[model samples]
Target: MDNMDFSSFLNFNTVTVAIAVILLILLVSRSLQRPANVPPGPTGYPYVGCIHLLRNRNILEVFRELRGKYGEVFGLKIGPNFTVVINGVEALKEAFVKHADDFSDRPGGFLAEVVFKNKGIGFSSGENWKQNRTFSLSTLRSFGFGRRSLESRIQEEITAYLDVIEKQNGKPYNMKDMTVMAVSNVICSITFGSRFDYNDVKFKQLTSLFAENFRLSSVAGAAQAFPVVRHLPGDLFSVKRLVQNFEDIKEFINEQVIEHRNTLDKDNQRDFIDVFLLQQTKNGEENPVFDDLNLTTTVMNLFVAGTDTTATMIRWAILYIVHYKSVQDKLRQEILKVVGTSRLPSLADKPDMPYYGAFITEVFRMGNIVPLAVPHGAKKDIHFRGMVIPKGSFIIPNLDSVMTDPEVFENPDEFHPERFLGENGQLNGKEKIVMPFSLGRRACLGESLARMELYLFLTSLLQRFEFLPESPDKLPSFDATLGLARASKDYSCRIVKL
Candidate 1:
C-alpha cells in the first residue's frame, strides 16, 4: 500500500476514536442530570420504585414518626415511582400556598390513568382541565350559587330536608341515606332537573354502585403501590375489578345519556347534561375535545362530588351539634333571630347568621374529611423549600396535619366553633386553618354551591329539629374511615323533631 493510502486509513481511525470519546461524555452527563435537583428519598427497590412503602399504607405515619431521622421532606417508593411528602402545617402552607404554582398539577399514575381517566377537573391537566374547571365555576355562578338569586334552590332543598325529617315523626332514623338522598336530590335538581326518592331502588342502586367502586379503589394498596401490577390482570390485586367497575359506570351513564338526549330541549337548557348536549350539537363530532364521553364524565363528576362531600359533611355537622347541645342552641338562636319561625332559614341569612356560619366552618375543620388530599404533581421542574422535587414526583400535602396544627388553631382536636369567631364575637375568617375544599387554582369548583346548601339546610334543620343520639348511652361514633375522604366509620346518626 502507498503512503497516501495509509494516511487515509489513519485519518479514518482517528475520527472514529473521537466519536467514541464524545458519546461516553454525553452518557455521563445524562446520568448526572437525573440525580441532580432530585429531592432526597429513601433508597427504593428495583422495578417497584416505591411500591413497597405503598403496600404498607402506614408509611405516611411511619415517616411522621421517624421525622427526626429522615427530616420533614422525605421520599416514598412504589415500584419505580418517587413521591415527596410534605408534613405539618408549615410545610403544607409553604408548598400548597407559597409554592402553589410549582406543585399545582394533579398527579398521574396507574389509577389516575385507568380508574380516574384524567377527564374531569379533579384529575385532568393542561387546557382541557382549565376549560372544564372554568366552565363548572361559571355554571355554578349562573345558577346564583351563593347570591340571593341562587338561594331559591337552596331554600327549596332545605324545605325538602325539613319535610323528610318531619315525616320520620321524631323516631330513631339513620341519617346517612336521608342525608345523602336529600343532598344528592338537591344536586339532581341542579344537574339533572330531576329528583329520586330515598326509597327508590334505582337511586339506592346508583349510590351503592358508586360506593362499591370507591371501596374497590385502594389508593394506598398494591395497584397504587406498584404501577406495573395495576395494568396486569391478577387477583394478586383487584385491578381487573377496578377496570370492570369503570365499564359498569360507562354503561349506566350511556343509559342516562340516551334518556337525556331523547327529551333534551336545546332551546331552554336546564341541567348540566342539557348544557353539554347543546355544546356537543353546536360543535359536532368534528370537535375533538367536547363529546358524549366528556359530558357523561363531567356530569358524573358533579353528582359524585356534590353527593359524597355534602352528605358526609351534613352527617358530621349533625353529629357535632348533637354532641354539643350548647353549640346547637346558639345556632338555633341565631337562626330564629334572623329568619324567625314562620319560613325556613335560607342562604340570604348567612351574613347576619355569623354564629351559624362559624358553626359550619367548625364542622369542616372539626370533621377533617380527606386527611391527605388527592396527591398533586409538578408539571415542570420545581425547586421548593430546602429540597428540589423533580418534575412528575408525587407530592402529598398532609392536610390532616395542617387542619389540626396547634400553632394555627387554639385547640386543634376539640370541636370548638368559637375558634372561628372574631373579637367582635363574629366569624373571624382569619386564623383560617380549615381547607376542606382545597386551595388555589384547583380549589373545589362546587364550593359556592356546597356552601349555600350547607348553610340553608343546617340552619333550617336547627330551627325545626334537634339531632340526638339514639339512646342516652349511645353517642355517634367518630371513627374515621376512607373513601377518598375520611368520615365517621360506618357513618350513622339519629335525629329528633323540635
Candidate 2:
C-alpha cells in the first residue's frame, strides 16, 4: 500500500510540473513578442497578422485610414514579416531620400526570392541591381532614350496606331486592346527590334499573360506579405497561377532571345537585345551579372514597366477627357494652336503647350496609378522619430498620401486640372504635386520614355478626334480595377474626328 501511494504521488507531480513549464514558456513568449520601438498598429492574430484587413479592404484605403488612426508612420505584421508604412511628405522624403541607401534594398520573400530570383533591376538588390541598372540606363541612352531622336520611332508607332483607330469610322469601340498593343509596340521596337501585328496570336497571348500576372501579383498580396504561407501547397492564393504566368513570360522572352542569337550582328546592333548580347560576348566568363537570365528578366522588366503602366494611364486619359468634355476641348484647342492637324505633334511642341502638360500631370495625379509604389526594404535597422525600423522590414512609401494630400490640392477628390494650371494658363511649377512614378533611388527607370509617349500620344489623339462616351447618359465608371496598376474599368467610346 505504501509503494502504490508513493508511485501515484510521483506520477501526479510529474504531470503537474510539465503543465507548469509549458504555461511559463507561453507567458514568456507573449511578453517578449514584437518590439517596444515598433510602430503601433491594429491587433493581429498569430502567424497571419492583419491578413483579414488586407483581403477585405482596399489596401491603399486601409493604409490611408491607418495613417489617420496610428499617425504618419505605423507598423503592420504581414504574415511573418513586420512592415513599416510611411505616409505624408515629410516621412516619405525622410525614408526615400534622406535614408536612401538604408531604405533602398528590396524585401526578401517568396516574390523576391523564388519568383524573381533577384534577377532584374525592379526587384533585385545590391550588386545585381547596380550592374543591371547602370547597363540599362546607358544602353537605353545609346538608343536615343529621352532624346528628340527617339521621338521619330514613337511618331511612326503613333501613325500606325492612328491608322488602326481611323478604321473604326466614328463608331463606338473599346480601345483597351488596340491601346495595349500600340503602347507595347514602342518597347517592343526598342527591345525586340519589331512590333507584333495587332491580330498576332502570340502577341495577344503575351499581353493576356502580362495582365494575368498583374492580377495574380495583387492576389498574391498576402503570400508576399507573409512569405511563410508560400510554402504551403494548394492554390489558396493563386500562387501557382502566378508562377505559371512567370514561366510563360520567360518562355516568350527566351524565344525572342534565341531568334536574336541566330541572327547576330555585333557591329550593326538592331535593338536593346542586340546590345545586351554583344555585351554578354564581350564580358564572356569574367562577367557575373550579364547572364542570359538577367538578359531575359531585364527585357521582361522593360516590357511590363513600359507597356501596362503607360497603357493604363493612356486609357485613363481617354476616360477622363471623355467624362470632362471641357478638359478635352481645352486640350484640343491648345494642340490646334500649337500643332495643327496638317502634321503630327512633335516633342519640340511640348515647350509651347503648357495646358496640355498640365492636363497630363493632372491625369497622373488623379489616375493614382501605382498608389503604394514599389515596396522598399530596409538593409539595416533604421532609427526615426523614436522608432527602430527593424532590418528586413517591408518599407511602404504611401504615394496615395502624397497625391491626395488635402493641404497640397484644394478639394482633393475632384478631378481639377486648374490646380496644376497657372494664372497665365501655363504649366505651373507644381511638378512636385504629382508622383505617379515614385521618387528617390527606386524611381521608374522608363520614366523618360513613358513621358515622351504620353505627351506625343495625348497630343496626337486630341489633335485628330474628340473622344466621347458611347452613351452620354452613362459615362464609364471612374472606379479602377485595383492591381499592380490601377486600371479603369472596361468601357466603349466613339472617336469623332475634329
Candidate 3:
C-alpha cells in the first residue's frame, strides 16, 4: 500500500470534494427535518409521503379540500418534506407580518437552484438578493411605476392593443396573444428600452415557453419537492428545456446591452439595462454579485415576474367582466362617467374612479393567479403564533384561502366588486384584506407596476369597448390549475367598440 503511493488516495479526497458532499447531504437532510410540533394535517405514506397528493389533475382541488378540513395553517407531507402553509388572511398576516423575518426568503426548492441556475433576484439569496431586490423596487418607483410617466407608457401599450382589436372590427377574438404582448412591452420598456410588436414571433415564443413552465403539475412539484427526482431522465429533460429557454432569453438581452453600451450615456440611462450597465461601471472589477451574469438574470426576473403575471391578471379581468353582465354594465357606466369616450383614463385618475378601482381590486381577488404567494424560507427558527416555524422550513402563505376567507370577505367566492366599495360608494377596506401583491419584505417587487397596469388597462378597455362572452354557455372556467402561476384553460370573447 505504501509503495503504491498512499498520498494519492489522500489527495484524491480533496477538501472541496468533501465540502461539496457535506453541502449536498445537508440539502438532502432538509427533506427529513419535520418540526416537532407542526400544524395539524392529514397523514401520508412514509418517505414518499403526501407527494402523491400533488401527482394528478385534481391537485388544486386537493389543496382546496385540505384547506376546508384543516382551517388555515396546516401541514402537507410532500415526500420527506413537511411544508406548513398559512391559509386565509389572518393566518397569512401572522405568517407574513408578525413573523415576517422568519419567512422572507425564497424557498430552497431543488428546481429553483437547478432551473434558475442560482442566477438573480427570483431565486438567489443572501447579499445579492438584497441588493437586487432593493434596487429593483427602488428603480421601478423612480421610473414611475404608479406615477404619471409610467401611466403614459401603459396607455400607449393599451392603445396599441386597442388598435389591433379595432382593426378586427367587432370580431370574435382570442386576446390572449395580444394581452401578453402588451404587458411584455411594458416590461421591455422598463428592462431594455424597448417593446415587441404583438405579432413578433420571438415575443410569442418567450411567452408560451414561460407560461408552459409556470403551469407545471404537482408531479413536477413532487420532483421539485424532492431533489432526487432532478437527476432522473425525465426531470432533467424538462429542466434542460427550461435552461435552453433561459439561454434564448439571455442571448437576446445580452445583445441589447452591447448595443445600449455603445450609445449609452451613463447619466442619461433610459431603461433597466442601461441602469444595470451603469451599476457595473460604478462597481468596477471589485463587483462580485453585480456582474453581467447577475445583471442578465435580474433583467430576466423583471421580464418574467413583470410580464406574464400582469397580462394574466388583466386577461382574467376581461374574462370576469365578460362572464358577469351586471358587473360589466356597472364598469361601463363607471368608465363612461369617470373616463369618458375620447381620451383614455390615466393613473392620476385612479383616485377619482372608485367603482373602477374596486372592480380592479375584485379582479385581483377573483383572478387569484398566484394562489400561494411564492414560498418563503425560514431564515432561522422562531416561534410564530404558538407554533415553531423551524429554520429552513418551507413557508408559504396560501393566499388563495386568504382572498376567499369568509370571515373577512362576505361570500368570498362571489365576484362582487361591491365588496371593495364602502357604504357611500367608495373604495373599501377590502384591499387591506387582499394580499394579491402579498406583504412584508418578500412581497412582489412589481406590485405597484402590476396595480397600475391592471387599473389603467382594465378601465381603458371597458371605456373603449364592451367585452362580451360569445354565448350564455360560455363562462370561462374558474378552475385555476396549479403551477408557479394559476392560468385559466381558455376563453374567447367579442369586443364591441362603444
Residue by residue across 1-498, what tens digits does model 1's lDDT show? 799999999999999999998887785454333365565656655455645554537543555554446666766554555677777766777777787777678877765576557776667777777777777777767765333245676677667677887888767777776777777777667766666766778777777766766677564345665666755555566667666766676677678778888998866666666766777787785564566666666777777677878888888888888689899889888887899999877656777977877888778887877666777887777787656777777787766656766777777779888878888987787536678877667667888888888877787788888877777688878776666667676534466676
Total backbone clashes of candidate 2, pairs 3 or more residues apart or in separate chains: 0
Q: Give per-residue lDDT, candidate 3, residue 235.
A: 47
TM-score of each: 0.84, 0.92, 0.87
Best of the candidates, lDDT: 2
State the displacement of the C-alpha of residue 242, model 3, in Å, after optimal TM-score superposition.
1.5
lDDT of candidate 3 over 320-406, digit per residue (tens):
878888988987887788768878887777788888778877878878888777777766776766777666667777777767667
**What C-alpha lDDT, on a 0 to 100 scale, does residue 270 get in candidate 2?**
82
Lowest-sum lDDT 10-residue window in model 3: 213-222
Best first by lDDT, ranked: 2, 3, 1
Q: What is the lDDT of residue 430 in candidate 1?
A: 52
lDDT of 2 by residue, 1-498 (tens): 599999999999999999999888885565337777888787676666777797867888888899999999999877767789998888888878897888878888776777778898888999999899999988877776433246777888999999889889889989887888898888878888877777889988998898788767666676786665667789887878888888889889999999999999866788888888989998893586989889999988898778889999999999999999999999888889989889999988999988877888888988999898888888788888789998988988889998888877889888888888789987678966588888788888988889999999988999998898887797899988787788899899999877
Q: What lDDT would each prediction earn against the true structure?
A: 0.71, 0.84, 0.75
Error of 2 at 266 (Å): 2.9
| Candidate with maximal TM-score | 2
Clashing pairs in 3: none
